[model samples]
Target: MGVVYIGDRAVGKTHLALELTSPQGNYVRVFLANQNYQNLRANLLNLDGTTKPTQTIEKRSLNVEVRLPIGISKIAVDWIDSPGELFRRSWQSEHINEWENFKEMVGKSEGIFLIVPPYREILQPHIESENYVTQQQWCNRFNRWAEFFIYDCSQARRIVICLHKADLINCEIEQEISKLNYLPHGSPLNWLQRHNYVVNNYFQPVKSELEKINKSRSGLSVRCFITSIYYRSLLELPWIYLASYL
Candidate 1:
């Protein structure tokens, strides 16, 4: 199974990857390192508090055995992590070969992990904001991706839309959550606390595009997740979801 991570630059793809592969404990446990995923040897941070964006493509593999109702199945997962710039319209022609390679890989992959950041910051219009992505702009961009997947990537069966940076979404509740000692993986209480914030502000804006993908492909599986690097289970579950089909 091939799973690729796709998101805008500075949205913490590298940071989230590191956290999943090299977990720190507060509330979350069952580290992915114990499950076989390892951190990449790339810079995760800048001098400032922002994550350093991926500049080139990177790949990793995990071969693990998962138990299913039928029996224990051995699965090998291929992860292709790439620079966010590859998704930009202006960059494609400049890096034609790389862009072609990227498209080819996605067309052949089994799953896609699409990371979306909190919309509170991105939805606010700022003419000078280099990184801010408006709702319309994001929707249009991802709609194109959806079209490509539907028409070209017939092999891609799972699309996991991860609404990352959950800590930044609801600051007040998160502060309260910070006081807690532990929270189990896939806790409904944790998701209930923040789902409305992300769903109404982030997911709703892109809902139409996502719905179109669903209607167009009967076999494709589309899932949304509210995730944070601080939460271990949130990051780990998406990989397990992708692996189940394999």
Candidate 2:
């Protein structure tokens, strides 16, 4: 199966990929075998705060064996990590071939991991700056991505809307979940309900837009998750969800 992780510049998509495919990384427990990530690890091993953004797309192949209700099934995953800027509209004109290649990859892929960061800190009070992207701007960007999938990648079966970098908003979310009068048994929907604030505050606009789009043309199985590399279990939830499809 083909899969891709899409996100904005500096939003941690590469970091998340590095951690997922790392042998010594926290997510090692989720994978039965991930020996082919050596090349990917070598390329990203020197990543740090000063690391430049990915300029070209990179692919990592793995035979992921996961337990299903039927039995053990091995899923061959061609995981693609692309340059964030390449997905933006502005870059489409500048990098024509790379941009088309990305769309083609998405069209052939079975799943997409849309990695998005928390917005609270992003929307915090700050001086007006050219680099600043407001919530509306984000919604616009995400909306465009949704349209791309709808029109360009109709073969995609699953869409994982990941609220990544959750470590940054974990405490506040826990407090909000604690205040809830009723909490259901564990599940993705229940988890979303428990962390309603994260949805309502951070992802509502995109969620609403997605709903509207889905109503018109439906087929995509959408799932949401609050992920963080700092929390191993949390980091693995999205992958587990993806595995369920297998």
Best by TM-score: 2
Worst 10 residues of 2 by lDDT: 176-185
Maximum-lDDT candidate: 2
lDDT of 2 by residue, 1-246 (tens): 466667766777756765665565432332314344555555555645334557687665655544445555555566566666765668888878877887787788887778776664443244233444566777877887777777887777877777777656535645433443221233334434534545565577687766654554566666667777766556666665676674
> Each candidate: how many clashes?
0, 0
lDDT of 2: 0.62
lDDT of 1 by residue, 124-228 (tens): 243234445655676776777778767877787787787777665544535434432123344334332343344555588777777777677668867666667
Clashing pairs in 1: none
Q: Which 10-residue window in model 1 sums to the lowest lDDT?
A: 25-34
TM-score of each: 0.69, 0.74
* Candidate 1 accuracy as TM-score: 0.69
Candidate 1 lDDT score at position 135: 56
